[model samples]
Target: MMYTVQSSGMLLKRFSANYVQNSTRLASFRQCERYGKFHDCRKRISHWLKAQGEQVAQACTKQCEFIIAQRIRRSLQIFHLYTRIWDEVALKEFMKSWRNRALRNSRHFLMSSIGITMYNWDRERITKDELNGYKKEIEGIYRLRDSTVVCAKCQLRIVIDVRQSGIKYCTCTDNKFNATSNQDSEGWKPYIEREDMLIWRREEPNCGGLFAYKVYGSFAEVTAEDFLQAQIDVDYRKEWDPTARELRIIDTDPASQSSADSHSDVIYWETIWPKLFANRDYVYQRDWVVDKERRLIIIISKVTDHPAAPSKPGTYRVTTYWSYMVIRPYTEFHQPGIEFGLTYFDDPGVNIPSAVTAWVAMTGLPNFLIRMREASRNYQNYKIAKQSLDASDTNYVPLKNEDIFEDKVLHGNMQNSERSEILNGKNVEDYNKIEHTEVPQFNEDLKEEEEEEDSTNSSEEGRGLLDYFYLAKLFA
Candidate 1:
């Protein structure tokens, strides 16, 4: 119950009759002790009522806070699911039918307007004044995700700054925030910076409270295409990536090779761990998006279940995580190269030693970046040899120019050498009809060593080296 001065006054009026009666009796007695006793009793009652009012006020405040928190949480859940679905549907439709920009805009507007209405309803119900300090915290979390939007009237695609715009939908008519032309858009704010590489980690939803880090830097002699090719090529990966002792393609589907669809692949990766540490392995689904219009190539990998390959022994399997690699062209400041933004997160199946984890965290990524560049360069050099070998396997015969003086001289010498056989045989040119071929040279020992190394590193059959995985699964 809420106490007020008006209510107190009414209560006092009701009790005034009793007080008056007592006062009359005391006055008749004309005793100072009787008046003193009456005054003390009135003061005690007032103090008791005041204490009760304070308790009621505190309870009301707590109830209001609880309501506000509940509303915020419910609204956030709605917003998260709504935005995620919106992104998926919009991207699918836009990619599938680029010519239907008008239809796409209408659909986007309808979806976004509905989301706004839903959010606004909750916002008003939340009662901004009641939230007090928690209002900022709730909105900050909601703004953490990037807003995907499209103009309703113009049918132009864009990504708006949710925090800055203060709305979920775009009001742009001229497409100022157009996605295709926004290569220079701001990146994630760095929370961890070292040696010119900025790394920022943020808690993502539906991730079991895990964190993912954004790491981007300029590496020498690497272009957007170079990095894309290097990351995707299976054989080239082994050359540069020292972390992964063995990487294999578990399976792949190329049915989505159309202009509208992206390619997906399932890969198995086994990483090299220290002597004391158990090895780590992963089976992940990777999706590739090579957007020529935006000059961006993105590869996203997420952990996935592959029954073809189960958890093996002696290795801890990463249970959860996703990684993103974004490649873009560099500006003059980072000229003669490209810029790569890499974001990765994973939960190792086992506990990691703090010292080893720290050491790897400090040196691993930088070394990987450096080695990736080196590997790209090596692949470029080795490509010439690879092409020749491929050509020989295909029995490719190249055309030769015979108009030059050197070619005429060689032809004459060959004719001179075959003259004696031609004169002796009834068919003169038969002796000179044989073809000559050159054998392609390659290192057999190196090939043998690579094959043997792969065999040694791969687990035997389906069994793993350790029993802890089985025990954990059984108990889990």
Candidate 2:
């Protein structure tokens, strides 16, 4: 009975140990399955968060693009509006100019008829032959409106056609002619010589046979472009020219007549006269051509009627006037300068002695040129200051110089036969055959008022009208 009881206790201890081992294994497997489910849930939540972030980033980029597009649309709309406003303004100005031009033409016609009648009626003072001769001379000058001239030095071709209201400059490289060989061929007589300047005179049969002067000289320190700017800068002229009593631009060429490389203006100039004589006023059309390749500039002015410059009471209106200037780059004394040829004539409507007139032409013209040269030298500084002021202003729209200096291929090369014909002067029609290349267009900016009241006042003290007339007493 004791042996059987011990065997039963051992069997009970073995069974309890096996049951404990099985329970620990089942508990560890349940813990591992729970850990795996938690990890899978965490991974799914992280993927959802990443997708939401990507969608938000895409939404922000679209919003920025939409805002930028809206700003560009708004800017384009403003630009179109401004363009329309400018177009309307330009139309109005054109109509007004047309009306004024018609009125002026009628007035000039009536005045000219009256003068012709008076001229014919006065037999004692002027004979019919004399009158006819004067008319012929005047017509001859008018014919120059459609003339061609070649530069003596460079053989550059220049065409002036006022009927077309245009001047054309062409390079004449193959054709050579010596235009300056015979000065007397053009009826020019050597009148005077001073320093390096040579003066020639051509007598007009009308107006008491007054002498018209032509001068050729070199400006020591000025460039051709600066000298040209000095001539055309009306405001700057007021500062330096003592003889000018009034100078203003009445009108500019209509847009139809203007081109990229050329400009024209109607200007009124009133010059001081001697003490006993009345002031002389001129209404003229001025045009200029700039040839960049040749470094040349040509300026021509002729009398024109304008309603804006009606005859003032005290001033003698000059009815017949013509002036032209040709300037080219020249080197003198190892320095680059300007060589100029100027021809000027006008009817002063007075009977001054020929000797006195000759003396004034010899002395006054040189003095005037000297002043112009000095003024041109100072213009560089003036331009810099003016540009600085304009740049500071918010409303200023700067005017761009025409891009005419760009290199261009010739329209068509002339054949050897054509060049020889031109040289022989047999093919006059081919002189203007070279067509200009189409220049790129730019928006025409509005011109600002160039003169200020303060500047006018400051310059008034030094500019005396009497200084020009002081020497007249010696001849009077």
Candidate 3:
């Protein structure tokens, strides 16, 4: 949405759009207009409640499914199953409970944060030209997020955690915190001159001589005459009387910076304030493979030819290649976010039964779920065609292979293997069927599929490839 601007008889190239002003506004509009209109600050809690509705659904309904399920597994597995059936629940006790809590709380975050009065937005009908102008504006805004990718073909960084105590020689010098010098009284006069705006510690008069002042934008500490004297320098105009808590622009005592403890407390709060109130949506968005750009044919329905969709029943067959996929939950989120993974093979013929729905229910992360649902839709052409259903010739059995398994999260290897051995075999269709039914079966079948899993299994101390999985039945 670029436009040519003629200003002062010179053509200037610029961009603008309605979306450029706010990511939430743009992304929300792309999702649905009703969401964008009613979910502003005034309606934020209502929207938040809707979000909690999903969370509640995740808790109550998801848990209920595990209780009523025909198949039973471990407690962890039960939690996993709960996620799979979360959206299917008919009632949400959790949502009702959370909404009640919100209404009753009337706390600061509930009142000030989610309230509609917090933001500025335009709410008028826009004409085509006006819309186009906004479009260009937004394109410009998005350009900021378009990073100057250093390496388009960069390999994934190997994340290997080294034990801190094991390192003997270090090449880099780590900076040790030195708060002692900062405690000197020399800077006190200047420090008080700049930051000595004081507040009564409490409204009660009996709170005594206690007073607090903002040290940084985020921290507060009790005031002392010493802190004030440390900030001044010789030849400065200030003076101070310790008893009266008075100061003028006089020379400061460098040694007056005693009590290094106050600075530590200030540092702690300075580190915490922004993180607690920072953009929470980015935390949620982190879980997803967001804003994917790929080459896809513009598909439309027609009498002469039909656009195939993976979502439509019978449009695809369960193929062996993609039918067997492996996923391990990433429950320990480094940040506030959902955790899950999805990998589909290009040639596998096994039907992915509402994979988007499955993943949404599986992770219980709303933003991640939405991203996956929208992103997975462009793969209709990669559908496992129905013809693949009958590709199995019993005699021409695709050689079954010994499974290869590695704990990548616990180890440096990414669970990818290059050693595989083709063992007694079965038709690939059978393997595909098992994969669709058992999660582990797919992982086992992977040894057969990939070029790396070509060696014989010799290690047998731990769980076998199939037995190692927490619960593999869902894929079967």
Candidate 4:
């Protein structure tokens, strides 16, 4: 009986131990299953995030490409528009020049024929009269007291009156009328009066009855030298003169280079005109004489011909043009001032009404003088700036030579054909459009040097001890 009871106790203990072991194993399996499921979910989430990131990157790249394409298209459109406008302007100018040339040729032919016929008839009549003892005098007298002419017909004593004389002389030939010496000469009638300016007109007998104008004015607070420089500086004139389409010194007198007081230049000037009227251009010789003793400056300009400045298309060549100016210090006013007298006349190819001419002279001359005065006031500033720029740049060379009086310099080492092409507008380039090279500022360069030095010092200070040791070992 004792043996059987012991056996039963042992069985019960073994069963309890087995039950505890089974429970622990089941708990561990559950934990493992949970961990596996968690790991699987994390992998799926990572894959999804990576796919989303790739899609976003692709979209961003596409957007950048679209923006760049749009900008390129816009730039191309602007360039095409500019080219189209340029072509249209060039075409219009060409057509206008063609029409003008045709008209001029036809008119010239007709006038030449008429002039030849008339000249022959006049010559025959004059010869016949002289052979018949009817000689005429060259000078006509108003009264018999100064009569030098005698009529050989019927022994009649008659004086050739000035009014009835057939021979007429150009008013410009008169020795008594000097534009520079006399500001108020005979036959000058007061035409326009302003508070600070006066204009007078004298009828030119030979210039198609056009009036020669005299303008006298005083510029307050402007020195004579400044005013003179403003007038003569072509580069500065381009900034102020609205009427000037193109002005350049084509040639300068080599002879005048020997004398400092005397200077001369041949200039090509094209002026802007209204829509219907053709443009006018002038190839003129300008002579200026500076007298320091008298504090007087004289400038004279007249129409002249030049091989370098041939008449180009799209403009009318002004054949008859003259201008004279006298500038001196003004002592009449308390403040420093300049007094100027200018006389000018030009026969524009097309005839304009006298009233329009008078009106233009009255309004245009005063406004021009006013602008010139303003430019003179700014001339000193411009000179100083130019000097500074010149001093700062050692490699700078002027595009146009300063001493262009030499023939070789004026031609610019170009072939004759190339020069003609440029002058005739075939290969002409817009000089104003030429981009000026940006010069480095002295202050900016100094700042850059300072920044480089500071960066080097900072990098040296930022080195770690290990990095320094490595570098030192490498150097060693």
Name the top lDDT candidate.
Answer: 2
> 471 in model 3: Cα distance from truth in Å?
6.4
Candidate 4: tens digits of C-alpha lDDT, residues 1-476: 33444465467668766544367755665565566646778888899989899898999999999999999999999999999999999999999998898785654455566632111222222122222221111001011111112122222222211111222212333323222222233566555544334455778887766877766564546666667767677766766555567888866665665655666777788776666667778877777666543445667777776655667888888897777677654321111355566767777766767776655565555445545666777776876776724644321212222232223222223333332111011211321111211110111111456446544533453232211110111000
On the 0 to 100 scale, the lDDT of residue 233 in model 2 is 70
Candidate 4 weakest ten by summed lDDT: 467-476
Show where candidate 1 strays beyond 4 Å.
Answer: 1-196, 202-211, 257-262, 331-336, 353-356, 388-476
Better of 1 and 4 by TM-score: 4
lDDT of 3 by residue, 275-383 (tens): 2221100000001011101100010100111011112232222121111111111111111111111221121222234444233223222222222222222112212
TM-score of each: 0.40, 0.46, 0.12, 0.43
* lDDT (Cα, tens digit) per residue for candidate 2, span 1-476: 33444455456668766544366755665566556646778888899888899898999999999999999999999999999998999899998998888775765566576632111112212222422232222122212211224344444333211111111234463333322222454666555544334455777775687867766655545655556666777766776666677888766665414354456667898878756778888878776665444444566777777656789998888888777676654321112354566777777677767677666666555455444656766766766666634644321222223353322223213233332212111223321122432111111121133224323433553344323432211100
* Quality of model 1 by C-alpha lDDT: 0.46
| Candidate number with the higher lDDT (1 or 2) | 2
The local distance difference test score of each candidate is 0.46, 0.52, 0.21, 0.50
Instruction: State the lDDT of candidate 1 residue by residue for 1-476, as single tens digits.
Output: 12243355467669776544356643544454445546778888899989899898999999999999999999999999999999999999888787676564654465556632111222222222422322122112112222212334543323422121212334464434433222113333323333223344554566544445556454445444445656776665665444556787765544443323245567788776656678778877776654433334556677776555578988778878666665543322112244456667777655545555444444444334444555554554655665733643211112112232222223223332333211011121221122221111111122457445444433231133222121111000
Candidate 2 structure lDDT: 0.52
Distance from true location, Cα of 42 in model 3, Å: 99
Off by over 4 Å in 3: 1-159, 162-466, 469-476
**By TM-score, who's the top model here?**
2
How much is 86 displaced in model 4, in angstroms?
A: 48
